[model samples]
Target chain A: MSDRIRIVVLLFPAMLIIVVLFFGGLVVGLMRSFNYMPVIGLTEPNLQAYWSVFTDQEFFLSFLLTFHIAFTSTVISSVLAIGAALLLRRRFVGRALVNFLFQLNLTVPHLVGAIGILYLFSQSGSFARLAAEWGMIAGPADFPELIFDPYAIGIIIQYVWKEIPFIGLIVLANMQSIGEDYESVARSLGATRWQAFRYVLLPLLLPGVLSASVMVFAFTFGAYEIPALLGANFPAALPVLAYRKYTDVDLAARPEAMAMAIVIALLSAVMIVIYLRYSRRRIRD
Target chain B: MTHVSIQSLTKTYPGSSEPSLDNLSLEIASGELAALLGPSGCGKTTTMKMIAGLLEPTSGDVTFDGRSVLRDKPEHRGVVMVFQNYLLFPYMSVAENVGFGLKMRKVNKVEIDNRVNDMLALVKLPGLGKRKPSELSGGQQQRVALARALIVQPKVLLLDEPLSNLDAHLRFEMRDLIRSLQQEMGITTLFVTHDQEEAVVLADKVALILDGRMKQYDSPDVFYKRPVDKATARFFGGQNFLNGNATNGQFKTSFGVLDLPIDCRRGTGTLTFRPENICVTGKTTETNTINAQLVEKIYLGTQTRLKLAVGTEFIHAVVNPAEVENLEQGQRVNIAIPPESLWVLTS
Candidate 1:
């Protein structure tokens, strides 16, 4: 009994810190969104901040753009990660070097990757200079605008480049845990190499793929630095918009930014709940 | 029809000093069950994988019914395998797992259903078609694996230590189940196992392999009653070794000189006999009787095992409990060797 009591006492500080950092912050942000804050001299709670967040034209466009970039990048990255994992499952010369290069992106910051993309795809970038030297393009004006395009293609490409390695590492770990017996059995039952992969390996890898997609989605959705650096001028991503609103000259717009933050959190929570429900149904059946 | 024939099968892994399988040759007749019995790293599983086309042989030719199958893939070889862990697809229901092969082969839906149902019934898992493998017990999962393999109606079935993962009692039950199923289906089968008892019980003929070489291939009874070499003799529970000389039908050992019931070449060699053949009695009236002290007695319920020390050598014997009632530890007893029970092996 004394040992149990001592263990609880030891865990008390860490648990309290977690509750404050996670749930407490969420509650405070949500209350601010409802305009119920005494620190800023607002006593009566209201929904004015939420209405502003919902009615802002830039907010709606940026929110949609955020969804577009995150969904596109996550889907493309997951598919490519699965392909790379399958290809590298077997042994070959210099395999360790290739795996190391793929995992190297995890250590580099997203801002650095965005800067690299900008240097490579901008108007006076190396690609445009090379195309001009090759006589394919007359001048820098002929080069396609990849960076800061209205479609967020540059941000999507950057996110995919950074997130593919993370997804690949997770998938490779899961693939290693699956035993070789499943493949052997499928082959002996008259499945070709591709057939075995399609029927057996793919089904067993579904859970890992779904979870990795969720992680990639969450990471890409909340990302601020990459989008802030690469997004279009008029309509930025939700995180970029929130950061701008929070630092506005008029302190009255701060509540709207908090509301936007709460909305983003709610969206991610809803996505996670939906994913879990679907995965549970799949496992149950 | 000859289901499987291997001519000069060999395999060498990269970075390994020696080949795993070297110049091996085997043949499995149609409707016969054969076991490749050996210890770990003895190339039993390697040989099975090559036959299944999962591993490419370095230099060899595998034939099915006189046609070379080396160029064909695993799906075209008409063979199925059951692994030791019963690798049932966790995502698929039992029925879907069993029917997957048929569906892959482009069989019609109705035919696949009938065949799947038939296989499920055969494995005694008739109503378990809707449950996933994770929801079932180990034995049931193994049965589903068996059903999945057999549903394809392949030319041959390969079983790699299919019962090693079960408990002792379940192992026995599954052993009998597999044997009965094999006899019923009559599909040419090749089973790999390290357990000598399992091989002897389930195989019509056992091929004892060691170090990438075939030591002996014969029926279990013959392999036990008359082993060809010292290693084969020792592997089949032949525990007693007597330094003796054989002349026609008689062997002269330290205990006594006795005549065997059969004739052999006249030579100076060693004689081997099983422990069960050496009887122990209270009196020394029999021929070839040596008086020795009982070293240990182990009561095995049905039979009591006794150890006797004669000079510098110790001998083991199993006797009926009724005959060993008076036998006690450290008691003097007479060890009798019947003449016809002794077997002679050269070198």
Candidate 2:
């Protein structure tokens, strides 16, 4: 057999599964949102579901809250990752230990991480218990609701913790491949340490950092587990809102749920599009 | 005035026993260009880095105008190094790369632009400022690195094998360019290179180092004529070395007794001379003569090189190409070593 034909034959099954499971599901969800689902006895297609979901005040609040959490977490995580990467670029005594500790999250599930956050920062959790014992607060209620708050502070904190090492790994790889010449050359040219980092290494590291940030933003925007556990009821994140809508008892709400799901998917698609465009432009330059 | 002085500078890597650079001291006058010529891993670059305040010395101190600079950082030492790779920032344009040092000093934008332009013009890269480093040719990139190092007006300039990266033709061109630029700027400079011909051609003084130890330091003219040892002589393209016993103004060798210029004690020493100085003669009426057979002959256009065996000792010689055009291998010839061209070494 020809090499090209054999290679194509080997790759065909995986590609077929991915296309059916991912894009096929997206297409079916889009069609169902338009009221074309024969399984639910919906006969006619209309824009009623999209219009209703777009006009819903609760849905709008959820969308905005999701955006807020994603944006804040991504920015903070990316900056911290860049700092950590720079700090660890030079080998030190404890560098291996630090690297191993941070990368430990990569294998641990995000759901587990969110629950861990719940145990640490929830109203009656370890932090409040410690605070109460230390006389920092009178009781669990006085500890302030960090988790399940309207701000989604718990979700943002968890996202930042989980995504920093991901972005930091990418940034550190870029730093290593560039070696030490750029920074050394900068210092020799009368640049202070800060100036050398800002002028030389920062510009080189931006593309990696921004691309990693885009990945975190897209993932956090659609992820349901963290927001589901830590977010409040009314202004829940978009994925959580979509789940609640999808599980409603009234059958008429199926179309609205699917519409919201499509919108969440659309948000991730838009983020990915921006990442590709921005990275392509950088590559061309 | 001595612009820079390194006093007993030594560097030993953590895992190594012998020091990479051992008790090295040298002085460079203002506006003089000195070349630290050595083979790879001979501590030339280490010495330059120590002077630049990039690498800390194991023991001694470096000073500029009689003040110790060991306490100062590399940024404040007024020392600039143009690395061998010509590490131009790929993200920045040529003008920005040249203006980077000035920007670090917080010079105003207008002054930076003006100085950048002037320095670019000085390096013969005028009006090419808008282009990025990737767009420029290798020679142009080298010019940008030079312009960048010079724009800051450093007190001392260090060039680490600046021309070693260029092609042979560009090497000569950049060599001349470096000469003119160093003369015009009048900055005290230390250049590190392994190429002996480059050192002799470009430097006012050459310090030849070997195995992390300095063998000789003098003007290129003096080093070429009188190398301090056999290693230094061999480094500067020496091939013919004859060990002989010397007494008074004469030397006893396997072939014959030869006359000498320096006062020689009663002991044995090695005789060294350049290949081109050993001439071929039909008969030696002047006393220093030997019958040798030509083993190999290589005609290098202007000069014909030949290895001759005299009493089981091989001596390499270069002759005028026209005179030895018909000379063939395995032929017998008479070789002569004149008194003035011979230098005696103990080892």
- Lowest-scoring 10 consecutive residues by lDDT in candidate 2 chain B? B258-267
Sum up the clashes in candidate 1: 0
Maximum-TM-score candidate: 2
For model 2, the interface Cα RMSD in angstroms equals 0.9
Cα displacement (angstroms), candidate 1, residue A243, comes to: 1.7
Largest lDDT belongs to which candidate?
A: 2
Among residues 3 or more apart in sequence or in different chains, the pairs in candidate 2 whose N, CA or C atoms overlap within 3 Å are none
TM-score of each: 0.91, 0.94
Model 1: how many Å of interface RMSD?
1.0
Residue B315 lDDT (model 2): 91
TM-score of 2: 0.94
Q: Interface Cα RMSD per model, in Å?
A: 1.0, 0.9
Quote the RMSD, in angstroms, for model 2.
2.7
How much does each candidate deviate from the true structure in C-alpha RMSD? Answer: 2.9, 2.7
